[model samples]
Target: MTYCKVCSLSGEHPGIVLDEQQVCNVCRLDSVGDLLVNYRYTQEVFEKFQRAGRTEGAPYDCLFMYSGGKDSTYMLDKFVTEYGKRVLAWTFDVPFESEHAAENIRLAKERIAATFVVDADDDGIKKMMREVFNRPAPRKPGNYLDEKLPCVSCRTFFVIRAILHAYRHRIPYIALCADPQQILTMESDVRRIVRGFYEAFGVALADDLFRGELEQLLFAHDDELPQIVFPFIAMRHEYDPDLIVAELKAKGLYASSPMETHCTLFPLLNYYSFTHWDCMFYKLNASSHARAVKRNGADGARSTFSLKFPRSLNVLEVEERLRTVTLRIAKGEGAAEEHEAALIDAFRELGTSEEAGRFIARSFLEMPAVAADMGIRLT
Candidate 1:
């Protein structure tokens, strides 16, 4: 794979344009300046939040979207311990949540604040995934995978849910646990993609997939949405996964080692996008990712647990994960075995036929004309 010499991003990343010198466009565009600019803005936002303290004895000051992961739990700790803010923790219980995550949730509540676990509409989510995956590819400049990523659907659900929870509770700011790269991606095209989802598939089906109230929340204007907060992003923090896990373990609030298990569909998405677009979603944030690496360097910099953030993980680990998934797809082992089991259950429970899975997997295995158009030819 060809990589940008300066930023170390490769051709497999989305939004990566290489110059004659082999430096990625991110490097060419001066990503360091972008990172600093984002940092300043987010810092201002966070300070404004600090000034607007909660009313004394209010049920909560802010609603935190907690996933029982280290980044989120760290935010929970920071809010309760550092800032002394009354936080209400929210967890969307995706169907594939591990038992370890449940334990982490229990510990989180014990250590910090009251937690509310909202069970995701598993059947509905599955149906949407089925719809997104099974549909014929849309004619677009980049890969449909760029827009059709399941993470968009999942994250949008929580964003809307957090907004609704905030509205009901009178919480002004909804704190997110995303890092700089995640903050960039999370802010990208979420509301637009969701709006398109509803517009494409009638509101009646949307209402069927999501609750009536949530459907309304999804369609709300961008400005009308809750004020979202990114604490780590505001501070420009780059934390080691080891330190985060250690901190939680010391508090006896975490039960498992840090693992980078993304959504089951993510591997499939990565495989197809890399094969076709020669650029994946993670690459979209490469510029900001490169900034973090340059500022901290390899010794001090932590990986963002993304392929685009090559400096975050050791070269071997990154290559192994990428190659492993590629090999799996090449062998017709589409999703991970665990995910295959979950997908089977999802299809059955959601009343989606097996053909939906077949269609998505088949789409992943093919090299579309778009790749050839982009001059990404494979043997």
Candidate 2:
């Protein structure tokens, strides 16, 4: 349970390495400064994007990816009023979206000058989600898998959708509003990973041609791709989460449930990670969070190791926790009513048939055995 004195990152995980001064690797990166560049953020690069995106006659300067979460809501206002950029705000309407987030989106539409676009492909998304939960995901080093692999796949879908949307509308820039702490991009594996999730359904599937087209759009050549703008990185603003929460409340953008501003699936994802990874998002992202705070602090700095800060997780602890939760759930010990509650709400939101939801639930819960049967090693 030991943690870095400076950053509070738990040492229980195999990743948190502390130097003689009891400072963490992440903290050390910030001591001299290097985190922002590692995350692919540089003043020159950001300025270049700004200069390139100002071309005349583009329908909008930026196509904002609005998730209706705290970060996106705040960033949307900044992009429009402060930066004075015309924006086409977009949302990928998923069943996993929280009611509070929906309300925030509604408020933003009424108040902000940005044009709004919302779309959903429930049938397609459901199949993709089911695939993510049903199959064993390929292991990646670090805490990459610490967040449910579905979160990665789903967010990538959101990013890809925004890119294609920008291309279609002749928008030169796409604005991503993922919280500042979520600085890393895993698109290198996402193109193939997400493609396999769909193509595995079968060749007879009607999406074959459209699927290929979507892939090309998702992984288009640099010349063909829309330049992306990471709000916090580009703006170089110090992200104060507490302040954002207070402002959201003062501005009437407060989400109803505190636990749900991010997503309804969050709890379930944490449960999955806690059971299998011996860690949850709190632990999964501690290093990243620390790095963000360091670089965005009163004095700016950046460090991601020097790379490898998240190191491998404690697999033995994960195994024991998994066995405990599995047995407790099997015996109806009421160990995870909260997790099931979120899942139930999600099913209701999706209008999923009871039988289908139950099947998904059963399969997701039995994932460990399923992975074993498929000869996939988890943990």
Candidate 3:
């Protein structure tokens, strides 16, 4: 668990390289000076995107992925109020959506006059999610499991679905509030994982015909991919969560705080926190960096780290929140319980027994004893 001197990254990070100074490659690639320049450069890119997107008689300027979270809410605000873009806000709802998030979506619809779309494949998605979290990570030659990151799988699905939607609708750009870490891995890493999955299991399931079909389905031409745009990355300002909260409140569109929906798979990730990939996405949120720093000082032995600097939050407050969440999860009182209840309800909704859910989940974990008894086949 050696941490980078510059950023909040650690030695266990994927493809991480350390120099004589022990700074991570990502930290070296990004510096305070370079960041200042990038801020201006990104602003130029945003303006250029805006200009190119301003076509006459276009139905919508950009397809925005709105999660009703603070980051995305700010993105929606800037797109509408600052740039005055005609946005089509799309939300991919899973079975674990929070009531508060739905409320925020409702308010966003009223506030922006934006076309709202929810891609909720509850039954299908529940099965997929179950598979993702329950299945164990793939094993290497040494019998060590790789990072079975459900977050990566989840985001990849969102990107593919968003791309297809934008392509069908002739949307020019697909906008998201993704941070630097997500931008680095979402496309390349996810595609690699998909190819690996097919390579490993496709041959067992199909002959040449199915293989050809799979190849065509996966290896789409460059033109078929959607144009991605990130407003938060472009606008290089340290986000103040409290300030954003105030803005949302003033507009009368603020719902409850983020992470209101407890994901059933999240507990599995926490248990695998050695990789620090469990809640990596959430940890990279706007203010989480500052929060983590405030709670655990730079020298403290904290498992998670943030890649941002110049914190705007009060250290004590952020530390308290983080501690509370950690304790609640450990005690099975707050989000953990919420996730458990949601998982059970989802099983009932799908007309499946709890044991059936467990059976389905075991297939993901690669537990041979249970999988064999259930007569499950991976290929």
Candidate 3, residues 1-379, lDDT tens digits: the string is 4655544444554445667897756545544465455455555656667787564545788889988866688779888898889899999885555456777778888887678898865544444445554456534321111343555556655565666677667677778776543344433222453465455335443223123333443576655444667666665355555566678879977765433322334434433332233223233332335434545775542312112233443323332343344334444454544544444433333233565433323322322332233332222
**64-149: candidate 1 lDDT, tens digit per residue:** 89888777877788788888887778887775454556778888878785556564666666566555544565444443236435
What candidate 1 gets wrong by more than 4 Å, as runs, is 30-38, 55-58, 137-148, 188-208, 211-225, 238-240, 260-266, 269-379
Cα displacement (angstroms), candidate 1, residue 26, comes to 1.6
Please report how far candidate 1 places residue 216 from its true position, in Å. Answer: 5.0
Candidate 2 residue-wise lDDT, 73-133, digit = tens: 8888877887888888889998667666888898888888899989777556655556655
Lowest summed lDDT across 10 adjacent residues in model 3 is found at 301-310
Q: What is the lDDT, from 0 to 100, of the residue 74 in candidate 3?
A: 73
What TM-score does structure 3 among the candidates reach?
Answer: 0.60
Global lDDT scores for all candidate models: 0.58, 0.57, 0.52
lDDT value, candidate 2, whole model: 0.57
lDDT of 3: 0.52
lDDT-wise, the better of 1 and 3 is 1
Q: For model 1, where is the 10-residue window of minimal lDDT?
A: 370-379
